[model samples]
Target: AQSVTQLDSQVPVFEEAPVELRCNYSSSVSVYLFWYVQYPNQGLQLLLKYLSGSTLVKGINGFEAEFNKSQTSFHLRKPSVHISDTAEYFCAVKGDTGNQFYFGTGTSLTVIP
Candidate 1:
């Protein structure tokens, strides 16, 4: 089984400022890491994935995350943000087969201008 923990439930920031959303996971086997963003009353969209190779992975909306095996963390970060970036973010883990997905409760990013 796999599980994810998002350290913060809400993060507020100013427009064009930097932001980071923390995430941690535990699994018995190799898995895929993903970050999804959900807009108001909308479905989640894939931000990025760490399938293999580099530990640092980039995604949409100027967001990026680095996979840390030792710490079991995949923290999302962006140097600058926009008010439009205001939304909910979720961190998820999928097994090798990439079938079932386990997600964190969610982190709401409120970008104020």
Candidate 2:
């Protein structure tokens, strides 16, 4: 089984500032890591993912994450943020065997103007 943990429940940042959301996971077998974002009253959208090869992966909306096998972490980051970036972020993991995915609680990002 695989599980994900997001240490921060909320993150507040000024516009144009950088932000990083922490995510950790545990799994007995190899897994795929993912980051998803949800806007107010909207469905979740894929932000990034780490499937194979390259430790670093980039996704839409200027977001990127690094897969650290040693730390069991896949943290998402943005060099600069905008007010439109305010949303809830979730970290998820899926094992190689099944279609089921384990997701972290979530982190709400508020971009302050």
Candidate 3:
């Protein structure tokens, strides 16, 4: 079994500021990780993923995440943000062979101009 947690429920950053969204997970088996973002009035979009290969993964919109197996963490980061970057971010964990995915509660990122 696996579960994910988003440490912060909300985060506010000024425009062009760097931001990091924290995520932690617990699982008994090998897993794949993912980060998704949902902009205001929009559906969830896949930010980045760690399906295999490298531990560091980059996604769309200048976002990236590094998978830390020992720490059981997959945190998202962006060097700078835009007003349009404001959205809800979620972390997910899934067993390598499972169909089910465990998702975090989600963190709201508000980019203040």
Worst 10 residues of 1 by lDDT: 24-33
Query: What TM-score against the true fold does each predicted structure earn?
Result: 0.95, 0.97, 0.96
Tell me, by lDDT, which candidate is best: 2
lDDT of 2 at 48: 91
Expressed as tens digits, the lDDT of each residue in 38-86 for candidate 1 is: 9999999999999989999999879999999888999999999999999
- Candidate 3 residues lying further than 4 Å off, grouped into runs, are none
Best by TM-score: 2
Taking the tens digit of each residue's C-alpha lDDT, what string does model 3 give over 1-113? Answer: 78899999999999999999999999745899999999888898999999888999999999999998889999999999999999999999999876998899999999999
lDDT of 2 by residue, 56-85 (tens): 999999999999988999999999999999
Q: Which should have the higher TM-score, number 1 or number 3?
A: 3
- In model 3, what are the clashing residue pairs, if there are any? none
Model 2 spans > 4 angstroms off: none
Summing lDDT over every window of 10 consecutive residues in candidate 3, give the lowest-scoring window: 27-36
Give all candidates' CA lDDT scores: 0.94, 0.96, 0.93
